[model samples]
Target chain A: MAFMIAQRAYIKLYLINKVEQRRGYGYQMLEELKEEFKPFGYVPPQSEIYRALHELVQEGVLYRTKQLKGNDPSVDFQEIVLYHFTDNGAEKAALYKKQVKTDLDRCIGMLHKAVADNFV
Target chain B: MAFMIAQRAYIKLYLINKVEQRRGYGYQMLEELKEEFKPFGYVPPQSEIYRALHELVQEGVLYRTKQLKGNDPSVDFQEIVLYHFTDNGAEKAALYKKQVKTDLDRCIGMLHKAVADNFV
Candidate 1:
C-alpha cells in the first residue's frame, strides 16, 4: 500500500468507531479490527493494537468497566474489563469518520477525473 | 485531519502521478498540486514539494530535460528545465494511483457500511 495510513493513529480511530458501534473488550476489538482490515492488507500487530487501546484509556478517550462472568451471586467469577467510549471519544470518532469520508470522496473523485481525462 | 497522509511520502506519489499525467517544470507541478489538493485542505508547503521533486529526480524516478525558448535556434534564450517521468517512474506512479483507487474504494465501502449499519 503506497498510501498507508499511520497504524497507531488509525487504530485509535478504529477503536472509537467500533465502540461507537458496539462496546467490547480490548481483545474483542483487536480481533474485530484484524478481521475488518485484513481484506485491505492492513491487519495491525496484536501488540500495537493492545498498546493503542491502553493509550486510549490513559488519554481519557475510553473508560473500562469490570464485568463479572457466570452470573453467580455468591461465587467469585472472572472479571472482564469492557471498554467504553467517553463523550469526547465519541465526538472525536465521529469527526474522524467524517474526515475519512471526505478524504475518500476526494481521492476517488480526483482519480476518476485523472483516469477519465487521460484514459477516456 | 485525523487521518493525514505522510506528507513527504505522499508528495513522492503525487509528483510521479502528475508527471505521468503530463511532464512539467518543478514550479509548475508544485502549483498544480497546490490547486489539486487545496480543495482537500492539504496543499503542501512549497519547500517540501520542491524537496520531494528533487529527491525523486535524484532517485532516478524522474529525468530532467532542458528546453530552450524563443524562436532563434542559435540565439541565446531562457532555458527551462522540465521534469519527466522515467519508465520506472511511470510504472510506479501507475501502481500508486491503483493503490489510491483501491484504498478509496475500501474506505468508502467500510464507512458506508458503518453508516448503514449504525444510522440506517
Candidate 2:
C-alpha cells in the first residue's frame, strides 16, 4: 500500500506540475488524492500523504520549500511546505508513470482471470 | 508492493485450493508467481514471498503446517510448511478479490485520464 501511495503521489505531482505549472503542498496533494479515490470509498489519510512525500524527498525525487501563506505580511501567516521535483525526481516520475500503467494492466488481467476461473 | 504481494499470495492460494484441492508451500507459490510475472520482466524474490506469507499468517488469514516430503521412512525427508486458509481467511480472500478488482478499475481509469492529458 505504501508503494501504491508513493506511486500515486508521484503521478499526482506530475499531473499537478503539468496542469498548473507549479509545485504542490502536502495538504493540497492529500486533498486531491482523497477526492480522486472518493468514488472507491477510500480516503488517503494525511499522515500517509506526508510520509509518502517525505519518502520521495529522501529518494531525491523531490525537494521541499517552506513558504508562508497570507496576503498580508503584517498578519501571522500559515507556514506550508511545497514539494518540487528534482532533476532526477522528474525522470523518476516519468518512469514510474509508465511502470504504474503497465502494472495496473497486468494486475487487472490477473484479477479477470481469477474471477473467470472462480478462483476468488 | 508488499501489500500487493500479500494480496497476490492470497489469491494464488485461493486459486490453488480451487483447482488442486490442496494447500501450497512457500516455494511453490514463489515459483508460480515468478512464472506469472516473468512475461513482464519481474520475478518476485523468495524473501518477499515468504515475508508476505508470514504476514498473512500473522493476520489470521492463514495457518502453517509442517509436513515431511518423502515416501521413504528410513531417509530424512524435507520438511515443508504448507499454508491453509482459516475460516476468516477464506472470507477475507473473497473480499480482497472483489476489492482488488474495484481498486484496479479505479486505478486504470485514473491512469487513462492522466495519459490522455499527457500528465505522465
Candidate 3:
C-alpha cells in the first residue's frame, strides 16, 4: 500500500541504477545516484538517499559486508561498506529495468501513433 | 555513462517508492519490490535480489543492524536484519522523488498540450 505511489526519481535511482551501471555499492553508488539525479534536475537529499539504502539493506533487498570498526584504512567515512546485490536483488533490479524500458517504449509508441493518426 | 540509460521500470521503483509510501526495509522491502514488478510481467531471481541487498550494505549506502543468530526464535531465514537509512541517504531519496514527479508531470502536460492543440 505504502511503497505504491505515483512515481518518483526514487524508482530507478538506487539499486536499479547500479545494476544497469554494471555494478556499485555504498558511497560510490551514492555518487552515481547523484549523477543520475543531476540531469533529472534534482539532487536527492543525501540523508534520504542513505535512508533508502538503509531501508533496502534492512529489507534484505540489499546485503552489507562486515563492518570496519571505528574507521577504515581507506575511506574517512569510518564505515567499511561493501553493498552488493544478492542474486535476488540483481534479478529484481534487472527485471524492473526491463519492464520500465518496455513501459516507456509503449508510452512513446502510443503517443507517436496518436500523433500520426491525427496530424500527419 | 552506464547508470544513464533507458529508464527502466526499475527506476522510480525502489527506495523512492518505499519512502514515498512512507517507509520500509529488509525482506519486507523485497516483498514490496516483488509486488511492484508483478504487474510489469516479470519476476526477478530471489538470489539476485538478495545479492543486490548485500552489495548496498557493503557500499555503506545502506545500513544493517545487528544480525540474528543462525536461527532466531522467530524467523526461518536464519538472519535477523534491522536496517535504517543514514541521514545522507534520506535526504537524497527525498530530493530525487520530487525531481521525478516533476519530470513525469512535465511529460504528461506536454502530451495533453499536443492533444488539445490538435483536437477540437
Best by TM-score: 1
lDDT of 1 by residue, B1-120 (tens): 113334575577667766766756777788887887665565578888888878878877788898776578589687877888787877766666576555545554554444454443
Candidate 3 lDDT, A1-120, residue by residue in tens: 121121332333345456445555566776765675465454556676677667666655567785554565576546557667776886665565455444554444433432332222
Candidate 3 per-residue C-alpha lDDT over B1-120 given as tens digits, one digit per residue, 9 for 90 to 100: 121211332333354345335444566776766665565444545665667556545545456675664565565556556555655765654565455444454444433432332222
Task: For residue B43, give model 3's deviation from the true position in Å.
Answer: 26
lDDT against the true structure, each candidate: 0.66, 0.59, 0.50
Q: Which order, best to worst by lDDT?
A: 1, 2, 3
Judge candidate 1 at residue B119 and give its lDDT: 40
lDDT of 1 by residue, A1-120 (tens): 123334565566667766776756766787887777565555568888788888878877788888776588479677877888786877766666575555445554544444454442
Once fitted onto the true fold, the runs of candidate 2 whose alpha carbons sit more than 4 angstroms away are A1-23, A87-89, B1-17, B20-37, B40-120
Candidate 3, what DockQ? 0.02
Error of 2 at A92 (Å): 4.4
Q: What is the lDDT of residue B106 in candidate 3?
A: 45
Per-prediction DockQ, in order?
A: 0.15, 0.15, 0.02
Q: Isolated chain A: TM-score per model?
A: 0.65, 0.74, 0.53
TM of each candidate vs. truth:
0.63, 0.55, 0.35
TM-score of chain B of 2: 0.72
